[model samples]
Target: MRIYLPATVTELGDPDGLVARVVHAVTPALRAALPDEDEEGLEFAAQLLAADDSLDLLGERPDAPLRRVVVAADVPQEAVAPLADDDAAPSAVRLLTAVPWSDVACAHVDEVAAAEDVTAALAGDEDAADRLADRDLLWFDVGELARLAAGHE
Candidate 1:
């Protein structure tokens, strides 16, 4: 159950704090989304910690435009599939699994990207929005995210 936790780092605030907030926001979402699971929370937390370690190892700048935390564990595969389908708002955070894209097969991903682009453009960052539009990047799989998410009590 590899999970891809995509996050954005903006110039408005602290990157590390933002990451922590994202983690806090996501933990409960994951738990609610997978009610049958008991240890998912701990596993996800550990995976996030490992992701932080990897980032430190790579000497990644905290201010990078986009930062992703990969979490792997044995949680339910369905728990993370909806992230690719999120398209409601710019600040909408998503958690997705590494399963094939054909599973959800909706315009969710495109819609989300479009919304983000529009938001960026409206904020006078058309260049950034354009860059986002031109690319077909889909953040997938958090390496061992699923495995890590399922290992906790």
Candidate 2:
């Protein structure tokens, strides 16, 4: 199963993929939420949820750099299971095991150019936060995640 894992840049290639993330799918709930939504919309919604999960992770780990990170990983379908009921959201699932680096297809992270803005947003600047939200995550090939995790600038 292809899943989106929220993460920090430093954790990009780590074997442990458990973090504040929601492994999402086109569940009946999601369909009900947007009856007209197509496959592309559902995928985008999952990505957005992954981004939101990254924010939750940042909140829990204040020492982490201020940036959004989401890893697109492919694991065995059997390795995943549906999450329990949550009226707030029903499209989420859980990964029952750790995700090795080899399963990662790519990573989406804040661009170096947006780091300053992200920092400012993290400091509680509403305008900066809004602007930073407008910025999109930059995609990096999975092979590059190791380099990034190795303290590359």
Candidate 3:
């Protein structure tokens, strides 16, 4: 199953340092919620949900740069468990094991220009959050993560 893991750039400084337990994926609940959407659309919805959750992760890591990162990985079917309806968003799932770097396909991240908006959004600025919601995160190949994590993006 392909899962979207909320993350921080600092974590990506080392492939082995990127850690995530709760992830977003195309769950049965998500399918039910967007019955008419295509597979790509469904995956995008899950990725957006993961992006939203990434903001919360940023809140906990003040030392990390102000940015949003979502790692896209292909994990085994047995690795994920969809959360109960009342537990989380429809796309949310719990990972049963750590994902090795080899499983990661790529990442979606906020551009450096989005830092001010990300900072504002983290400070509870609704308009800034709305702007972030409308912004498209830049795609990065797994190989470029080390450079990105080094703040060279």
Strongest candidate by TM-score = 3
Query: Could you tell me every candidate's TM-score relative to the true structure?
Result: 0.23, 0.80, 0.95
Cα misplacement distance, residue 20 of candidate 1 (Å): 10
Write down the lDDT of every candidate, Cα atoms only: 0.34, 0.73, 0.90
Instruction: Indicate which candidate wins on lDDT.
Output: 3
What is the overall TM-score of model 1 with all chains considered together?
Answer: 0.23
TM-score attained by model 2: 0.80
21: Cα error in model 2, Å: 6.0
Candidate 2 whole-model C-alpha lDDT, 0 to 1? 0.73
Ten residues in sequence with the least summed lDDT for candidate 1: 102-111
- For candidate 2, the per-residue lDDT at 40 reads 84
Worst 10 residues of 2 by lDDT: 13-22
Q: List the residue pairs that clash in candidate 3.
A: none
lDDT of 1 by residue, 1-52 (tens): 4332323322112222212221112344455655675675544443444333
Candidate 2 ranges beyond 4 A from true positions: 13-22, 85-88, 116-129
| Model 2 lDDT per residue over 12-72, tens place | 7465544433566556777788788898887667776777677667767777777788888
lDDT of 2 at 71: 83
lDDT of 3 by residue, 42-73 (tens): 99999999999999999999999888999999
- lDDT score for residue 107 of model 3: 96
